[model samples]
Target: MKKKAMASFLIGYTLLFTGSVYWHGQQFSQPIASDAGQLLPTAVKSIEQAEGEKQLQEMVRRANRTGDKLSIAGMQHSQGGHTYYPGGTIIDMKKYNKILQFDPKRQTITVQAGATWDDIQRRINPYGLSVKVMQSQNIFTIGGALSVNVHGRDIHYGSLIDTVESFRLLTAAGEIINVSREENKELFPLVIGGYGLFGIILDVTFSLAKDELYETHTRVIDYSQYSSYFQNAVNSSQVKMHLARISVAPDTFLREMYVTDWTNAKDEHKLTAYNQLKEDRIIAAPKLLLGLSRYSDWGKDKFWELQRTYMKKGNGKLETRNNVMRSETAFMEYESSSRTEVLQEYFVPVSEFADYIDDLRNVLENEKDFNLLNITVRYVGKDEQAVLSYAKVDMFALVLLINQGRSSKDMKQTEEVIRKMIDITLQHNGSYYLPYYSYPTKDQFDTAYPHSKEFFRMKRKYDPDERFMNFFYREYGQ
Candidate 1:
């Protein structure tokens, strides 16, 4: 929560919006402000809102009165907190979380922007319908998911945007627009992956399907023989959910494949409330169980504590559909190094999934300088959020997670690999998702995202004064 470090980042905005008397070293109609010189930590103030349009107006008025750069985020799970733009106000939608309507016949529910995936599940569970994708850990707010275009359970459902039926978005110019496929069709897909560039998402009403159990299955497949195997899994009818999780080693790449099938959700064997005090769900199943541990905004320590508790109940070996469990936390750890810690992840086009994995395996096997941990490949449905939607390639996505320390020399090594990865991705018209931004150069992003120019054009229309922007976007570089 330290606000002292960003005195320099603040200068960029101070200089960018310096034309008018109303500016005063701050943005016009922005709710985030600070003392001249030092950047302040943007904290989430609930503003004690009621459930209606009045609350929305009051919130917008506050942003204008404050006159600092302001942006609205739902769960705030986005890494680096929207680093593309500098100091801006963040309107956290977590407080406005409530289910506005549920149309059972239509198999859809409308919830407040701040409602988490888990929140929606509980609200509609009694009706026997469930969200299709269930993106990531189920803790992400609806608005945040759309902002980032979250995807989950590979080979099953597409990105969360695929399930979105409609949404109410507040444009930068302070206009509320209700968008959907058959309704406001053009604006529909554009806003889902729109990355909050065009507007602030207020509420989302998406479609859902009847709840079904998943018969869990898992196997250890060698990395050398992954491409064809993965292609088959994606197209397979029996394999509803397929995931590629890689473990890095010197000689061999250990890839774990998780495949699941549909079962009866109403079956009594499904998860029931357990007597355990620390954890909520437990699986009473066979050995060789495959459980899921996804990421959540809650503190990493608190999340892992829950995971450990869940693990203690049953072995990680064999698990059944009714017995499978899920925890909200990614298992990425920093390797012990002498200097600083830095992270870099690059996405490769699905068409070249084979080559990307081959090149990475060659490096990790031959080179000792790189200490690799996670190498995940998943699927994404394309959208227009960022100019470079990794979803453009309707195939496999290979991620190389690198941990380079914060030293000058280590950075050089990291940059070299990153540049190469970006080159490989762009060679086949692929783009990286929002994990590590610096890896892809501005030129690379423009190439991957041909329509990105339109995103900037729309930004000017809404945030005409360039008030809602990030460091990456402000520089006109990727």
Candidate 2:
């Protein structure tokens, strides 16, 4: 039981994780300080007991009466980085995990908030069903995924919220309320990506595609042809399941086109899945050398080898989707950037895609010391399920894996690059995805999520005592 309890640390590291990680009755070790993919801090970790309605209600009353912060729980993968702790109590929901029910006829399942994608995967693998959308990684909890309304390689699968049929929210008033598409449709729209601000999501019901799904196809294109190539791929009739474009163009070649395709879930492209599942292997090279590829045309074969060797360690012809998302062995082993303090995941409306791309390229070229890696452009459809939802349109999400680990001057340059990215996205009437690491000015957030007022209103109606604010709340929350 003690060893089982230590799994809660997967949430990543923070400078001051609260002192609460004991389960069934054993504490976890203090996490080593490094920038590598982090583990949950030893502090504030606790086992997730099955607190009945009465117990939950009593806890709420005590919190409300004393104005003590409630322990907020869910998957803690905020790209905004280390923004949720210290004074804000944590509710580690790892053990609250359970597969409540599966409606095979409806392709939907109701599960506890703490269930990870992996947990869901193991259960559904035999039945051949899977969530419609998942992040680049699958280690996050279901509640966290729904709260953020995550998206992925598929343009048509919709964000995670689109698949949610219902969610049971435990209000700050200790009221256990059941909400769904048919009931409390009002709350459904707001709470999906509303973050845990509305209530503690006890369980969620969402649609899943049967394993009979298939994704077949792959095309590597240049960015110069992005306008023509991307729209064509999205509009393609040949591809069925997955459709995305990755830039394999020369780093100096701004015109990297999409490397994308379609696959079937049930059919299991064993060939394709095999490679994706393989773990990444990196040969730790100096950080500076890594930056040179973006500015110069390191030969495609050379860069490809460099990436494959450094990331995959060797050949990975026999990998799986789960492997692709789970393994972080590709990241540098050296201490993660001390300066790695900010992240910005923004979404622009479909109509603004072209302008946004042009603007992004201009910023990268013109901004001094502006280092950007892993620029991922994904598409998302409308989700009425979440008012603060960033997927209001077919979103062309330009994920900026920017490098900010440098001196103050370099950091300032990084900020300007982010500022440019945000300003342009906002000007185009786009919204910001709040889950990732970011340091957007309050004004930017306000403009990006003006409907945040509705989220605030929902929180007041339910979590009035302000028990669940995260690092994000430090500046803009109650």
Candidate 3:
């Protein structure tokens, strides 16, 4: 019996891993483009590689000459059509990546826009330095993160905009200009979260932080108690990084929650003991488990139970900051022609968290085909540095991952639920993230982002010809 069970497990693992490899490794045919969401496949004029600044400038000039709109693409992780436009040229920046400068004394690094956080981590990990603010996954490019002005688990920082020192931009007219807080200050805020409508970000200089060791802590509590718990225990303590997961399992379903906090290690000497950067490992098993959670309620309950057990076992583990930033994403890879996983984030003022969660619970419970998979919560300090900033106040961001079919009916159902969620967000004085599909009405967007008119106006002022464009601009700018 034991041998048969072991054989069955091995066979399942092999099939799952093989499927993942095949899906992730497939290549697309020419003139076809899509973002990571795989929801909107577009036919484009051409896709071009960006080799250097001069080459990029020439490409932009040629696009303007030919009346072809240009869109910038990095790792293309955005669920929205932010990276491509129909009949437009895509400037692929992945190969233009290179570290331009690093100042060890000041703890600053400048790199080409195409450089991924992973590239920067490998270079600076040896010097005991790390990125101050970035997304949870390292596969995303710096340009893409800056365009979105992303945030992560760090409690000490505000958002990615706070750490950016300077960057060079290639405007629509093929002019390269240096932009920073001190010089070209007006354009500074407009471009960070401008969603590639401004221009192509060439290279960026960012402030860095010293690498430190952290001791992990985890606790399970009622969903209502989370806001108060974070305020009193996590924020007022030595916790440097924190995030929480509200249960999506059928049994718990927004009632049970677990918080993970990383505080300074009790032993400073342990920093060196675990300072080496860690890479993702043993992903196939987790991928299999996530697949189970995506399809069945029983699988979700078991997955939740296993997740709690995993977090419990990880309590008090010591890890370096770089290793923590290198969060595993391989296990979440999903590829299906008929179905896909989509992410939508909502941010509510800290005071409105419980109320917002209550409404969210009601909505999810009533919608049977919603296929809500996971919800991870992170805190963002009040930051208005970016013109399109999402965190107007000290807010709790709920990142929701849902599985949906590809049919028109499925999309309509998904959009309806999303609009309902957005309406709830507005009622709670909150905002939804713009990196996803354009499900919210124009009125909802204007209400959430009052300064969006100014942002779009500036986009036209900077590029009157509309040489730089994407589906995001088409959805909101016009």
Candidate 4:
């Protein structure tokens, strides 16, 4: 009898322990931080999923009743403090992700706000379809992409807003509104790039394009000749995608550039399935190169040389649209806890591309201890819809990817470089992206985004208590 009782007690204890462990694991998961690992903040509460419209409404209503500020987060890739509010409620949208509808004939997809581009690609690729516009990587959520109004290498498409057919937004008052170019026109621009200040994105419907085969081509040209080269070669060609990479080595510096152009190819049979390429190796190579490049200038030169050589193929090699569009872990390589990599983008008028590059090179050369890893140039046409549009005019966006130590001193130096870059951008009648670090002063912010005051007024009208707030709005919305 004693032995039987002991055995039963042990079994009960083991079961209880196992159940508790599982429960705690699910309940006490740590709060998420931005990709840069810089903007981690503790929230008073977090809701992982809305489950449905009624649940989302209840969550928002509860937050409003308790006078709690609510912050919306998707993949949390934005470097700035956009994902979390201090001691506030964070609504994690990842679990809410779902493909709500797909119209194969119209080539359109309507998805829950939390669905990442990767999710969309997986679903659409089987049909030989691809997203019309997205950032280079596929990890970002559609809602996050819309909030930032991301642009890609598609020079013709301009920005994500250009492809968006419509989206449903849940206001602070728990009312869901459908906004598009034709309907609810007043809220269209504001909500697209509003950075989740006005409302919570519920679902997004966007147009898609048929994936096609492309032939890869490249040309190494002087930085000064890029503008003319693009106008003559790229603009006239049937190129579907294009971007130019400028060397960051001290020797070659910004003087040399490699243009990678993908033009439509006749050989459709060469198109490969989206999942075939071993992205781990493809992604790991760059991270390894970047790590080595941080040590010496030789490493930097060799890395750039390798990139040009490896990426370029002699004229007839076929590349699929999805292959070019898919990038898995290339941007997710910051392994150092003491240092981080950040991105800054500036859009300059097409005419000012050369001058802006020159000034940028000068500023970078003058700055000490600056790790200018890469500079990618992308062409963007005018996007007049977004109230705080980055590409107000047809422009060439210069994207700078740099590394900085986490120390305060390194951050200060980084800020100095950023300020000088911003000043140069302003001098050239350009605007800088606001999604990264909050280095720009209020004056710079106002000058870059003059229509922000109106955007803030709309926020006030929509969210009377300023319920939806983040670092970007806190710093610049006023």
Candidate 5:
């Protein structure tokens, strides 16, 4: 009888696993929604044509006259409804991509708002130049990154706003004006991290960094010592780009961390050898492994071991700056109708790192609903450039990727965990990132961003009609 019961259990598990794989395969073949199926249907959505400025201006003017809300969007990677309004018009900018100017001598590149980092790297890589600061993935558009003011693996740099030289903005009034530190100065900071509530970012001019070969280094360290370790070695040293991952597997669960540092190779021969940008070829295997980890403890333990081993094996490998910027993202994609992955980032001062980690571990371990896939740690220097800057002081950013179901109960549970996490973040003098879902309440948003009222006030002042609008404003601007 015991043997019969065991056999039945094994057979049931096998069937369930097979069904899941089959369903995933069917979903994966089609277009995946990055908004995690939360996007509300808009009344009008039009792709921005390559016909240029006149067409865009006309469209904006038409919207203003018609009193239709206008929401500008790039890659639309923002999980929050930062790119949409209930019945508003979406001006899709992906097709408007074009590299307008490239001056190798000036170490600067000017590109249309719709152009992505991938496009910029392709244009600048051969010249031995690279983007100064951007997210780890090169798939995001330049304008989107600017709007979010994304920071990256570059420990030496601040956020994306630091590298920006200037840009042209099409205000709600249908007037195009140049904005920068020296010109239209107030709008400079607001629009960088403004979440498209200000105007349409037409084009951008940002500084570039030299593309150099880097020698990779990896080390496992205790969570408590990370703050000190970063200060002494990674932050103050010659490291060019640095990123660390805190183990979220059942065994480690934020107690253990592994850091990867990239420093100048200093050898011209190695530079040429590794100058070519890389593309992920073995995505299927890793994707399977990652998918397995999302469901079971056994899978999580194995995946954690594999991740550490992969990092260890890459130690001392040489890679170019441009190649490192375009890390593999295809394998991390999930295309399920019932489940999806979401990101939440918190920025805490360096002094509060260990305490915050302890609090984070406690909250996550006690939470029964949310499945945290991974946490990647990166250093963000003091950034006062943006009006709604997340990093007020030199800080450490904890980027958490979590898996949650699509059901209403699942969303409520996820919200509870997120709210608890935000409370912890606030306690540690940290600020939560605004690009993710709207789990935090209006009060939480106000507490985290002290300038919330002022930001909204400025928005109304610039465009009283609220011509430039998004769900972000709808939630917090009131």
Candidate 6:
């Protein structure tokens, strides 16, 4: 009987190992690309995921010695080539993740650059604290988030830089410098939203918020009414968080919109442990829906409608702030072989929100091949610190999730439509985000970010050799 049991266990183990190898092999053999799975060469030299600051420094030193360029990556979610360089050293920052410290009294947490917001939440939730600002999703690493100066649903907070207390930066010349608003004030803005060009981020200290219970509510309204609705009913101290979703279907399109609100809950109960909420439980259904939506437009429309009507109808569902902020499994399930989904964001002044939406609808409606999966609108106040800051003025951010084929022809068509979209944004005196694909021309980029000249000039002054570089700089750093 003992021999039979051993045989059974060994056979089961062997099958599991074989299956794991096959799954990994499929993923590896598909292609060499970013998360978007577009604009990639055949392969890269190698990837080294640094485990700590020592390892990261050694890798940078080796690259400097060998005259090899280095690419910085954490989660590699930036659809464009900002995180990669062909035939260059790739320093993967995910393994370097570590939470250094948490001060409950001060309501601040200090963490390694690679630590994700999810990591921070796990430690601070017990203390009844939450992050002040982060992107809608929490899967991105702290370093990557700061690199982009990401924003969140918090209408009051502008961007990640606002909540940042300080950070340690490892320069290309192998010098670790501490920067903040009060100390090393000049370099502070350069590093934030700098896209990791100036140097490597060691760790960051961020301010935290109280973790209180929130009651959520949802309503559908016309796109035209959003501006006045926001002024009259939405923008107030009572509303803690809010976001609007617009229909992408060709028929109704941008005409219809829905607003979801999360306010401070009046009656609260014992909060659930952050670790106990299984993130994967809510992701499977959405992944399956997305896969099915790929087959038909009606399926896609149904998915969006379902999301607004049923999924987002909070109806006073009480949840802790930490629970509402947790998005570990929110956006990590896009694993497709044939097609890839990429993000594009445009920031228009709040007053021009409706007009911008009208123009976006016209282009999306006219472009036959443009497959817009989702559109989310968030309010962001002006942020002047980040040199390449996208939110230069009080604006409404139009975040678009687009799906496209892997072929160059399809990408070209997508780029053409995106150029038109950029043109529309430019006409409205807005700017496009730099984290996505390299679709915008040099002229468009300059128009959007007029500070590029000064930004690159500072980059040259700091790293004269241009040792720190990425695809974004290569294309538009002139």
2 or 4, greater by TM-score: 4
* Number of the top-ranking candidate, with lDDT as the measure: 3
Clashing pairs in 4: none
Better of 2 and 3 by TM-score: 3
Question: lDDT at 478 for candidate 1?
Answer: 29
Q: How close is candidate 3 to the true structure, as a TM-score?
A: 0.94
Residue pairs with backbone overlap in model 6: none
True lDDT of residue 84, candidate 2: 38
Flag regions of model 2 displaced more than 4 Å.
Answer: 1-58, 71-73, 81-86, 213-216, 241-250, 264-334, 406-413
Give the CA lDDT, 0 to 100, for residue 394 in model 6.
85
lDDT of 5 at 89: 70
> How does each model score on lDDT?
0.52, 0.58, 0.87, 0.79, 0.82, 0.78
Error of 4 at 115 (Å): 0.8
For each candidate, give its TM-score against the true structure.
0.71, 0.76, 0.94, 0.90, 0.92, 0.90
Off by over 4 Å in 1: 1-53, 61-67, 83-85, 154-156, 182-184, 251-351, 364-369, 381-388, 399-413, 475-478
Worst 10 residues of 4 by lDDT: 16-25
Per-residue lDDT tens digits of candidate 2, residues 1-478?
1332222212222123222223221443422111111322324322234455465567666667776564455555464423235434455565667899987778888888888877776676555455667886666788778777788765667777767778898877777889987887778877777666666788888787755334334455555555455567554654443333334334533455444444333445553334323334553342323433333334332453354334333222232344433435233222232334334677877666666667767766666566454556666767655677776666667665554554657656666667777888888888777865445777888898777776777767765567666545555655
Put the candidates in lDDT order, highest first.
Answer: 3, 5, 4, 6, 2, 1
The top-ranked prediction according to TM-score is: 3
Per-residue lDDT for 355-470 in model 4, tens only? Answer: 88898888788775898888889899888779989988888898888877778888888888899989999999999998887889999999999999999999899899888878
The segments of candidate 6 whose C-alpha lies over 4 angstroms from its true place after superposition are 1-33, 268-278, 282-285, 328-332
Query: Residue 332 in candidate 3 has what lDDT?
Result: 70
Cα deviation at 87, candidate 5, in Å, is 0.8
